[model samples]
Target: MNRTLTNTVKPDVISDFKEITKMRLAVSVVFSSVAGYFLGAEVVNFVVVLLLAIGGYLMVGASNAFNQVIERNLDAKMNRTKNRPIPAGRMSVTTATIIASLFTILGIVVLYIINPVTAMFGGISIFLYTCIYTPLKRVTPLSVFIGAFPGAIPFMLGWVAATNDFSIEPGTLFMIQFFWQFPHFWALGWWLYDDYKRGGFFMLPTGKRDKGTAIQIILYTIWTVVISLIPVFGVTGRLYLTPISGVLILILGIGMLYYAFKLYKNKDEKTAKQLMFASVSYITLLQIIYVLDKFIRIWI
Candidate 1:
């Protein structure tokens, strides 16, 4: 009986550990980093790209674990988060802390091997996400704004990893992602307002799912679309898209805006959910487009 229980419990523990790290979200962040690497790299270094992906995932996972540790009690109050490892009592704070520490240390060391700038940005991303944004979620609506900085870091960090420079190109990538998160997160906040309120988190700019919130989402969506196209102007120096890719990005941006408009008009949970999914699809496809356009321009 004891041996059977141990075997069962061990697998459960491992699953819970993965949950605490928010593995899916971490992996997505790594994908963005990889896209940035591809966009910036003239000669792709497969080994460095691998390291960036690994390091990016570790830092993102560590940030999520730290967030869970700090918000365990708050998380327990939200239906969506109550089943998470920490809130569900499936994982202890001490264990999570150890995991976070190890990930942070290893992630920084791995990035530093590529360049100190890459490691510095990685550390800053973790710090901003865990130390600042996590607690600010309960204090003010600006937490989402603060969180966007760290959220945008992976995209720029990839460029820094490739070139070890913080120039106009990476800055443009950072801005594009920075504005994109507002609409994306606000749509999610709108749909999950009740759960977030129950969790004592103030994520929406307007503090409620009203016209004010919807308006902000639309505005940011516009800004995101505008900034994403700026690179095509060639003013960014190292990163410029061709006419075809620029049009593709414009169409994708409009697709996201269409959902944002629908959410505004309907002001319902269903519309908000659609907008949330659209936001995800928009960013992912936009990143892929940027990478593909980068190589296509060379071939053409």
Candidate 2:
């Protein structure tokens, strides 16, 4: 009886935590910081990574909180997000607001200690996502475009924090992530267009499933692959591309595009889900490959 009670109660507690901090969203944000850090840091700094992990959580969590605050009603109408804390009435607006505010302020402070540049971008991402992008979602499908700015920042945020400057390296990282977002999110929009329609979100250009959006996905997927190879070409300053790594990246790009075209051809929910999953794998693997390539080059 005691063990069963603890297990049941534990889920409730975990769900509450997810609601408060938007754990799923925060995990992505921290990843950005990690990607950025690895690209910029000349030497591994555990302390910096630690601070970034926590601070990135707060910054992304704040955005997630505010997103829920604004979209609480809309979320309730969607099956995918219906159980979210705010939509489900599990957390109050007032408490969520306070928690978000505290996290934002605390998170920025932590990043500021690392450097003004990291803090500046961190602060900007929060403002853009919460203040600009969140409101824009209801008004325009272009909100996804606007949101990409903040979304792409985390992968480059570490470079600024470690180097305390904006340079081509971080720019490359930002651009890579920026292009990656369109295909990834568009796949999601395709998958969840039904739910989104109920909430008045104009996610697809056609406002219905069609080839136009799928073509855009293929274009972006192509662009994403092209950009992934730029660093290996040694053309981007502070970024170099070697032959072996180049071949590996090309193969990976093909994998992503294969699935992208599959979605484009079928335009079914299952294909869209596969493309979405493939995209996640693409980006995460790309980051890992970049780090590995760096180690190989340095070692060689």
Top-scoring candidate (lDDT): 1
TM-score of each: 0.97, 0.95
Worst 10 residues of 1 by lDDT: 12-21
The RMSD (Cα, Å) of candidate 1 is: 1.2
The 10-residue segment with the lowest total lDDT in model 2: 200-209
Q: Please give, for residues 121-193, the per-residue lDDT of candidate 2 as tens digits.
A: 9899999999998898778878889988998999888888888999898899999999999889988999998
Q: Tens-digit lDDT track for model 1 on 1-300?
A: 999999999998888878988988999999999999998898999999999999998999899999999999999999999999888887789989999999999999999998999999999999999999999999999999899999999988999999999999999999999999999899999899999999888989989888999999999999999999998888998898887889999999999999999988999989999999998998999999999988887887
Candidate lDDT values, in order = 0.92, 0.86
Instruction: Supply candidate 1's per-residue lDDT for 287.
Output: 94
Candidate 1 has a TM-score of 0.97
Local distance difference test, candidate 2 = 0.86
Instruction: Tell me the deviation in Å of residue 242 in model 1.
Output: 0.7
